[model samples]
Target: MSVSVRTRALTAADGTLSHRYMALRSLMKICVKRRSVVTFLALFTLSVVLINTIPLLPKETMRLPPRDLKGSTSKRLPAGTPSTLLDLPPPLNGHKNKLFSGSSAIPFKQPLSHSVKAPVTSQAAKTLNSSNSTRLCQQKCIRDGGGHASVAVGEAEMTQQTVREVSGEETAHERKPDSFWKRRSHSFAGKESIPRDRMRGEKSDLCQISVGKWNETTPESLPWLSAGDVRKMAFLSGGVVLSKARVPGHGQVLQVGLGAGEAEAEAEAVLDHRQHCQSGSCALIKRPSDWFEVLAFHLDRVLELNRSLPSVLRNFKSKLLPYRYISGNARPVVWWDPDIQHLAEVDNDQNSFSLSWPLYQKVLQSRCGARVSLNATPCVGVQHSEWGRLALFDFLLQVNDRLDRYCCGFRPDPSDICLENLLHVKCKSPNDLLLVHILVRRADPSRLVFIDNAGRPHHPHDNLNFRLVEGIDEFPERAVSILRSGCLESMLLRSLSADRELWESRGGAEGLRPIIRTIQQRGTILLQHIQNRILRLNKDL
Candidate 1:
């Protein structure tokens, strides 16, 4: 019996061991079958973990190489190098620009009568220098927050390709050298040294033609709340001196709110000629106490037009405004704030393009359906919006010196003007050109205040009848009915109020009749002109 038990135990052990061996063999077979997929998954997980663990690095900053004004744009100058566009004549054939690429010109201003010389390299540089001068200036302007900027593109690599989706008739150019910047835009591009009179400094003892004797009072005493208040305050104050009411072309632009170097851009207009004024033109201190400015404001207000920029005639003096006319032809030149004259041009892209006053004039002069670009979007020059209303404003005021005028001081050519005439402008997009109702949505309201209402001819025939406005006919009754009304005298007198003698050479009430009559006669002529234009338009259509 003991022998039988031992034999049974040994057999059971052998059977159990055989079962374990079979299970282990089956597991090995399963592992071998799925090995490829498992191995792939393991490798993928490892890669993902590694990728997640690695830190992302910041973008590397690229410092622009110094400029080589010589035809070659690729070469870099040594550190701390000083160079200028005037250093080398621009190549006769346009070269690559450092800041702007492609063949587009960076627009600059020339006085209305002045034609700037295209003397640089007769060849324009295709590439803009990113570091040193023009390019740097553009970059700085863009960084000012309200300005626009573009990515630096190399001209050698870019060819002009028309994008079809831009709509309308025109395609945008990239500040091309061939079209816009025929001449260097820098303030010092053509010359050197910012002479003192040409310099934008403060004036003291501003020359004033005081009509009545009054105690001296501070400019702060003047309330800018309304036209009457402003005139009243200016009248109560002693006649302070006014000085240097001259710009390159228009002598009417007087300095008021801003002083020399108040803004870096303003300083540049003084220091460099190429740095165009923020406004294509400069600011002026217009005298509404003369009431022409107030008259304009009142007319626009009653007419519900856009010509008024809130103005106050205040007697103030600055160090730069130190010229006091003791005698002679010096009249108290009117003073207005160019700063608050909410008229800024919407230059889409060309760094301060609207500042190129004459260039835009050329654009305006282009046929009615002319097209341009702002922010790479195609913007057509149609006679349908606020731009058209400006013509009416100019027509009413008899303003001859619009953008172009003969300049004075150092750069005395008609191409240049004193910094005071430099306008304050901002950029606009093609999107801003909506229906007149939505025009204010995407665009800044163009309060084109015609502060330079000085020197308007007493008779309209001298100004209104001879020259015609561009888009005058297209404006509707809402825009023009005020010009035709009999209430113009009331409007003028209302604005003049207690300071009625200031309107004309102090003949008191009798002096006002002819001026009012002249305005009424001009209104009749303006209506005739508009009717004629509409009739002609019907014929053309």
Candidate 2:
């Protein structure tokens, strides 16, 4: 009986082992069938996470803010007004209401004149014909302070009366045969005298002249002049000084002598030749206030004056300083040799193009001296895409518009020859990209600086250094190629090296770590989903 039990136990053990082998085989088969589905799901999840995480990555890798924003801070108070309370209008329905009551103000109405009397002398009639006749009389009247008001008006009115008297007097002086009664009738009409008060008031009416002295207690005693006070001062100065002097010709050139200098010489020549004095005289003592005025006057002329004169004499003395003038806004003055007729006209539409003013300036400085003639042919190379062409055109238009507005006498030609071949030849290295960025930074450093949420300074770098990968020929082109080559990791690595501290401070490292963790977690979840699906399939099997 013991031998029989042992045989049964061994048989049962073998059957159990066989059952386990069969289950293992079925599991392997299920895994093979669902392998593709599981892999696809895992890849899909990873791609979704990567796409979502891209924008969150920190752009700057170097520099840091003066302070961190991790903790709460006190809110800043609003800025106080600089103007005094007295300078501002009184509060609604305040003292101003009582001061300017309608009934208390006096109305000074001027009287009208009817007929004017003739001048007695011929010499007086001759003086009346001159342009300064009214001016002389007005001056005398102002000096008398209303004492000579009637006399001034009488002098002006007598001139008109003299013309009528001349017709009667002309016949009498020539001893003409006209009757005395006829001459008497003419003389009576000419001598019809209007009252002095009426004539004086009529003359003063045109000017609306007022003669009143301000007492020490008057509001005029205030330290500052109001708009009305300024207007009154301008009026008192006479309309002659206020009017713009009329020049005879539209294209006339005014030669201004500027002290010796290269800039001054060029400006003088530009003015001497009567080239559009877009920038008037470099020697002009008057200074313009803003960009509009600068454009109206011309930069070259302004620069010349800055070089020639003292700070006190220079217009816009602050802007004329060598390093102070920003360069990116300047329009490129393209020059091409007319002799190079054999070169095919470049189709600007076919290529993408951008200009680095600093790089171009460096090239010019190195190859040609400071006073180098820019008449040499310029080669341009641009990418063959619609967007590239659009960008190039937009840049060109911006340049031209700025030049037209600000650069005096600069007129960009639309039909200049493009040195397409030269651009391809010159910009054939990754260093060119660095040079461009450096130039842009030099032009406007604020553009690249980081600003925190509270509008505080975030990144502060004195200077930037760029690293280029080996075997890359053109910097900009290589950058674009790297972006296209799905080498975003390498590209970002290169960019971050420029400013690593910035990336760390902005939680870029932390943000990327989370993304990586999410990707791994998603992989595990995908595996679980696959295992569950396989179990369901086996149950069906």
Worst 10 residues of 2 by lDDT: 449-458
Best by lDDT: 1
Q: Which candidate is the best by TM-score?
A: 1
The alpha-carbon root-mean-square deviation between model 2 and the true structure, to one decimal in Å, is: 40.2
Task: Please give, for residues 336-400, the per-residue lDDT of candidate 2 as tens digits.
Answer: 11111121224221112333433433432332211233333231221112112121111211222
Give the lowest summed-lDDT range of ten residues in model 1: 198-207
TM-score of each: 0.35, 0.13
